[model samples]
Structures are given as C-alpha cells and as structure tokens.
Target: MGERIASWFAAGHRPLPWRAPDFPAWGVLVSEFMLQQTPVARVIPRLEEWLARWPTPADLAAVPPGEAVRAWDRLGYPRRALNLHAASVAITERHGGIVPSDVDELLALPGVGPYTARAVAAFAYGSRVPVVDVNVRRVLARAVRGVGEPGPARTNEEHALTEALLPADPARARLTNAGTMELGQTVCTARAPRCDSCPIADACAWRAAGYPAYTGPAAPRQKPYAGSDREVRGRILRELRANELPVPRDRIAQLWTDADQLERALRGLVADGLVEIGDGGFRLPMH
Candidate 1:
C-alpha cells in the first residue's frame, strides 16, 4: 500500500498553496476549516484573502466571530467559520497563539474534531498521523477495501481501517495521507471515476469487484435554499455583515416575506452567535 501511494504521489500531486514549504500552521488550519464541505476552487480565493488579513491565530482571534462569518462568504456552512473563530481564540489564550501539535490539544480546541486534529498535527507539525477525511475514506474504500464509497460520514471502523494503512514512518505517513487525498479528489471521484489512469487501479478492489454500481440507498440530499429558512438566515447575515450600526427589525423584515419563518431564522442566527441584539435591534459583531 505504501509503495502504491508513493508512486501516485510521485506521478500526481496537486499544487495547493497550503502544501508549500513556507505555509504556516495558521494557514493550514484556515485551509482545513475553509475546505470543510466546500470545494477547493471556491476555497482558494477566500483562503488567500483570509490569510492575508489574519496571518496568525492571534490575528484571527482578535476579530469578532461575526466578522469571521462575514468573511466566510457563501461557504454554505457558516457555523464552521464561527467554530474556527472560537478555535482561534482558544489557540491564542491556551496555546500562546500557536496551533498546538498534540492531537489531544488540537481536539480540545473548538471544532477540531478527530480528522481535523490529526490533519493539523500531521500536516502542520510533521507528525505521523492518518488524515481520514471523506475523500481519503472513499479512495481507501475503493482501492484497498474493495467497497463502494464509505458511508455518509466518518465512523470508528473507517478511522481504524485508515490508521492501519498509514505508513509506520512519519514522513511516509504524511505522503500517504496526501497521496490518498489526491487520488480520491482527482481519479477516484464520486461519479465517473477515472480508473484507467489511477496508479493503484491494478490493486483496487472495487475494479476487481467488476466496478459494481452503487446500488444501495444514496445519501439524502440537503434541502434546497430557494425558500428555506437557511436562505433567510443568509440574507439577514449579509445585511448585518455589511452594516455597521444595529439594523432595525424593519430593515430585516424587508429581506423576506415569510414573517414566521424569517423570525425563526433570525432567532436561530442570534442563538448561533452570528448576530447579536442590542439597542432594540440586531447587529454584526462590532469588531
């Protein structure tokens, strides 16, 4: 498995900015957070802008959470921005503004779950750890285990399976992680995979399994944004994010016609710390 991954790494590795030699831990952390559920192309510009503004964990920690959400743009998941902001503050206050190297320490930070913690530790600190993201999981599922894509989300079994495949050597471990991720992202894509060019195609179990189609129940699609509360919430946040002063409830009322659902969405934003109520109105964080 290690030899196969090494060959893939030699032949096809994407030139992402975060993988550069000069990339700092802060940049790596931001890239990971931004890449969550967001495509790489979309994340590139936003990541560059974000890193330019906040080059360090302390720089991000000093800003307000609302600013983080505003900078997040149309990333889909706004909570990740808030969680990242909180994690930045935690890193500043707890780890002296440096992204911690310890897996346990990284996990303790806000929004730094198992995969993220391991990724930061391995990628940023050059530690030996398996970074089992969905892409890596899917690639491993097809190439190694001979299964279809892994289930909707991470499970203990998936983590263990990936861990077992990681190279014992620390540097090789990093290469393995990067190689598997690249394979999944480029060759073993979710639909219409490019198996002919895949380096590991010779050993891939899925191909040996006659490339059986994913006949099982597909994952449920998310609700559309056309008329959902999520759309309303996005509008409310956009207005508040652009305004300095407290936006009157009337101004927010103008954004949507569904009074009841809009109200619920507004309250949800407030509850989520993406907005605050003061002076008889709502406002983005002043910072």
Candidate 2:
C-alpha cells in the first residue's frame, strides 16, 4: 500500500515551488509557516514573494519584524508571521542562518512545533521521519484504521501508526511520507473522498468496511466571520496596513461599528504583540 501511494504521488503530485529539486530549505520553512490554515493556491504567490524578497534567514532577520507582519497580507492568524520572523532571527543568530534538520533543533526554534519539526526534517532534508498533517491523518484513518475520520489528535499514536507504515529504506520512507500526504490532500479528502481513484483503495480498510459514518468526537468547527471579533481585527489591520503612519484612535474606531468588539480585537492584537499603542495612536509594532 505504501509503495502504491508513493508511486501514485511520484506520477502526479502538483509542482509546488517548495517541491522543486533545487528549492532551498529556507523556502520549505517559509512555505510551512505560510501554509498553516491558508490554502495552497493563496500560499503560492505569497511564498514566492517572500522568498524573492528575503532569500535567506539572515536576510529576513535583518529587517524589522513588522515587515514580516505586513508581508503576511490576509493570511489570517497574523501571529504566525511574528513567529516566523523570530524563528528567522534565531536561525541567523544561533545556527549561522541555516535551517536545522534535526527535529530537536527545529522544535527549539520559534513557531516550530512537533508537526512542523517533523515536516521540515522529512520533506526538506529527507530525514525519514513521519510527517502527518491533517490530510495524512485522514488517509491513515480510512486506509489503515478502517475508520472514516481520525479522533481528536493523539500525537504519539499518529506518529506511531505513520512510522509503522514507513518503508525500511530511508529513501523509500521519504517517498512514503510525501505520498501519504499527497494522497490525503488530493484523493482521500475529508469530504467526498474519491475511493475509485485512490491508489490504495484495494487495501483500504474503510472501503472493506463499507465506509461507516464517523461516530467519534467531531473536529471543532470554526466560528462564522460575520460580526465576529476576527472581522473587527481584520478591519483594524487593513486600516493600519493602508496607512504609513499610526492610525489615529478615532479613525481606528470608525472602521467597526461595534465599539465593544473593536476594543476586544484591539486589546487582543496588542496582547498578542501584533499591535502597539503609543502617543501617536495604534499601529503595527515596528521595533
């Protein structure tokens, strides 16, 4: 099954920039940060622009962190930009501007968590580590566990299951890692999986079990954006991004009608270190 999935991905995976043969590890790190919660289509252009402007960790580390936030440009979860910037600074200062391949070293960097650490080690350095994203988890649940959906994340178990499926050879293990993710992203999608087109369909336990409906605790759903504090935050950000100088407090207040919601968003942004209040007014942090 692993072999089949690797073969399937090798034959037809999308030509994303980070997947290119000559792509730098720095590019992979940037892509992983930008791709969080953002769709691939939106990430491609932003990734390209980010790499073009700051080709190395040292380059990004040279600039103000606010530049990174400004470059984030509606990616949502603006804090990831700060994390990426801080990580770049750490890499430049501690690792001689090189993205670390060791999972421990990667995890120590700002914004690099378990999944991200493994992903960079596997995908960027071909380190033979299991890289399970949401997509890969879905693939595992159906193909091996005979379930329609994975239950709430149990990190250790996910790694163990993915590791058990990996090939013995390092190169083959890398292929399996990439292929499983591709299979999940393209074929074994969360909604409306294409069982007929899946390369591992013959071996899929879920197919053999007649695709039972998932009865596990449901994945948490995102709240609606309309009239939410997030909407207020975005409006405030847009206003700040549009202006070179700090937006006046009154002008910032005019963007959202709900004063309480706007205040909450502003306070949240400041608390998150994404925004700052000063004598001039409210603005993106620039130190």
Candidate 3:
C-alpha cells in the first residue's frame, strides 16, 4: 500500500512552492501554520501575501505582535498569528533565525505542537516523523484498520498507528507524508470518498469490509457563528486590524450590538495576545 501510494504521488504530485528544492524552513513553517484548518487554495494567496511582507522568521520577529495579528487577515484563528509571531521571535533569538530541524526543538516553538513539529521536521529537514493530522488519521483508519472513520485523533493510538506505516527511507517517508495528506484531501475524503480512484483502494481493509456504515457515535454539533462571543471577537479584531493605532472602545462598540459580549470578546483577545490594553483603549502589541 505504501509503495502504491508513493507511486501515485511520484506520478501526479502538485507543484506547490514549499515542495521545491531549497525551500526555506520559514516557508515550510508558514505553510504548515496557515494550512491549519484553512484549505490549501485559500492558504496559497495568504501565504504569498505573508512571504511578500515578511520573508523570514527574523523579518517577522522584527515586527510587533499586533502587526502579525492584523496581517493574519480573515483567517478565523487570529491567535495563530500571535502564536506564529511568538514562535518567530523564539526562532530568531534561540536558533539564529533558522527553523530548527530537530523535532524536540521544533516542538518547543510556541504554536508548534506534535503535528506541526513533525511536519516541519519531515518536510523542511527531511526527517522521518509521522505527520498525522486528522486527514491522515482518517485515511489510515480506513486503509489499515478497516474502520469507517477514526475517532478524534488526539490519541496515543492514532500516533502509533500512523508512525508504524512510515518507510525507513527518509525520502520515502517525506513522500509518504505528502501522499497521505494529498490522498486524504483529494480521494479518501470524509464524505463521498473516491475509492475507485484511490491508489491503495484494492488494499484498503475498510472497503474489503464491505464499507460498512459507521456505527460509532455521531460528531458533536458545532456552535453557530451568529450571536456567539466568537463572532463579536472577530468583529472587534477586524476593526482593530484595519487601524494602525489604538481603536477607541466606542468605535469597537459600534461594530457589535451587544455591549457586554463585545467587552468580553475584547478581553478574550487581550488574553489571547492578539490585543493589548492601554491608555485609552486597545491596540496591537509593540515589537
């Protein structure tokens, strides 16, 4: 299955910039962070904009945290920008502006958890760590375990399962990571999987199990954006991001209807490091 999948990737891999030879670790790090939750199509434009503005970790670290937050644009998780800024600063200070190749050092970065650390180590430095995100977990579950879907992947078993399939060759490991992620995104999708076109379809145990219906507990319901504190927080952050200086509370108040909710959201941003409280109102952090 691994060889077949690798063959598929060798035949038809997309020409993304980060996959290029001499691709900087900073570029790979940015792509990994941006690709979190956000789709690839959207990440490409935002990533281009980001690299255009701040080409390296040192370049971004030279700026203020607030600027990073604003530059995050409409990406839903604004805190990620703040965390990225912090990570950049750490990289610049501790690693001499280089993204660390060691998994332990990479994991020590502020925003980098297990998945991001492994991804950066594998893709940027050609290491052999398993890059098992939700997509990879789902694909592995179906292909290896014959499960219709894996439960939430924040588990030890999921990590071990994915790691066990990694090729001993580093290059093959890198290709395997990309292939699994690509397969999950394109073919072994969450809904309406393209089993016929899947490279490892013939070897997939789930398909062999007659593709039985998932009888596990249903996924939890996501809260609506409307009337939620998250909505108010986004509105406040958007207003602050648009302005270069501190925004008055009254100005932010105009963006949201509920006063208390707006205040709570604003405070939440401050706590999340996306905003700072000062003399009159709120502002982005100084570099």
Candidate 4:
C-alpha cells in the first residue's frame, strides 16, 4: 500500500512550492501553519506572498507581530498569523533562526502541536516519523482498520499504527507520509471517496467490507459565518488592515450593530493579541 501510494504521488501530486527539494525549512514551517484549517488553494498565493515578504524567521521576527496578522489577509483564522509570528520569534531567538528538526523542539514552538511538530520533522527534516493529519487518519482508518472514518482527534494507537506502516528508510517514510495525505485529500475523501481511483482500493478494508456506516464520534460541524461574531471580527480586522492609522471606535462600531457581541469580539481579539485599544482607538498590535 505504501509503495503504491508513493508511486501515485510521484505521478500526480501537485507541485506545491514547499514540497520542492530546495524549499527552505522555514518556508515549510510557514506552509504547515497556513495549511491548518485552511484550503490548499487559498493558502498557496498567501503563502507565496508571505515567503516573498519575509524569506526567513529572522526577517519575520524583525517586524511587529501584528504585521503577520495583516499579511495573513483573509486566511479566516487570523490567530494563525499571530501564532506563526510567535513561532518565528521563538525560532529566531532560541534556535538561531533555524526551524528545529527534532519533534520535541518543534513542539515547544508557540502554537505548534503534536501533529504539526511531527509534520515538520518528517517533511522538512526527512525524519522517519509518522505525520498524521485528518486526511492521513481517515485513509488509515479505512484502508487498514476497516473503519468508515477515524476518530474526531488523533490517538496514540493511530500514531503507532502509522509508524508501524512506515517504511524503514527515512526518505521512503517521508514519501509515504506525503503520499498518504495526498491520497486522502484527492481520492479517499471524507465524503464520496473515489475508491475506484485509489491506488490501494483493491486492498482497502472499508471497500471490501462494502463501506459500512461510520459509528464513531463525528467531526464537529463548523458554525455559520453570517451574522456571527467571527464575521464582525473579520470586518473589524479588515477595516484595520486597510488603514495605516488606528481606526476610530465609531468606525468599528458601524460595522456591527450588536454592541454586546461586537464588544465581546473586540475583547477576544485584544486578549488574543490581534488587536490593540489605546489613545489611538483600535488597531493591529504594534511591537
């Protein structure tokens, strides 16, 4: 299965910039952060722009963290920008501007977690580690475990299973990790999987079992954006990002009528360090 997946990936995987052999580790780290909870198509251009603007951790750390938020520009979850900024700072200060190859050190970065740390180690450093994401988890559940879907979150068993399935060679392990994710994303999807096109379809346990219904805990549904506090927050940030100067409180208030929700969103943004309120009214944080 791993060999088949790797062969399919070699023939069909998209030519993503971060996947390039010459792509810097810092670029791969940035791509990982941007790819979280965001679509690949949306992240490509933004990731390119971000890398062009700040080619290294030191370049990014030199600027105000808020600049990262502004550069994030409609990525939806703007907090990721702040997290990336903090991680860049940590990388610059502690790791001497190099993204750590060790999973433990990568996990210590601000906003990085088990999955991300492992991804960086495997993809960026070519470590013989399992880099499990939602897609990889789904693929493993169906292909190996005969389950219709993986659990809501990653488990230790999933990690061990992925590691066990990996080839002994580090380079092959990297390809397998990427290939599993690619297969899951393009063929063995969450809904309406293209099993016929799957390289491992003949061996897929779920397919052989007639695609049984998933009985496990389902992934949580996302809340609607319309009339939500998130929308109001985006509007406020958009207004701020467009302006070089701080926006007037009244200007921000005009974006949303619900005073309580708007205030709550503002406070949340402030607490998240995405926004600042002072004599200059509301603006993206500086310094």
Q: How much does candidate 4 score in TM-score? A: 0.97
What TM-score should be assigned to candidate 2?
0.97
Q: Candidate 1's error at 57, in angstroms?
A: 1.0
lDDT of 2 by residue, 104-215 (tens): 9999999998988998888889898888889989999999899999877878889999998888877778788888988888889988899889899999999999999889
lDDT of 3 by residue, 108-211 (tens): 99989889999899999999888888788889889998988876555677677767777788888788888898899889999989998999988899999999
Question: In model 3, what is the error at residue 263, expressed in angstroms?
Answer: 1.6
TM-score: which is higher, 1 or 2?
2
TM-score of each: 0.94, 0.97, 0.96, 0.97
TM-score of 1: 0.94
Candidate 3 overall lDDT versus native: 0.86
Instruction: Between candidates 1 and 3, name the one with more favorable TM-score.
Output: 3
**Model 4 lDDT per residue over 1-287, tens place:** 78777777878688888788788899889999989889999999999999999999999999998799999999889999999999999999999999999999999999898888998898888999988998999999999999998977767988988888788888877888999999889889988899878899999999999988989888787899999889989999999999878898988889888999999999989998999986768889896
Q: State which candidate has the highest lDDT.
A: 4
Candidate 4 Cα misplacement greater than 4 A, ranges: none
From the highest lDDT down, the ranking of the candidates is 4, 2, 3, 1
- Candidate 1: worst 10 consecutive residues by lDDT? 212-221
What's each prediction's clash count?
Answer: 0, 0, 0, 0
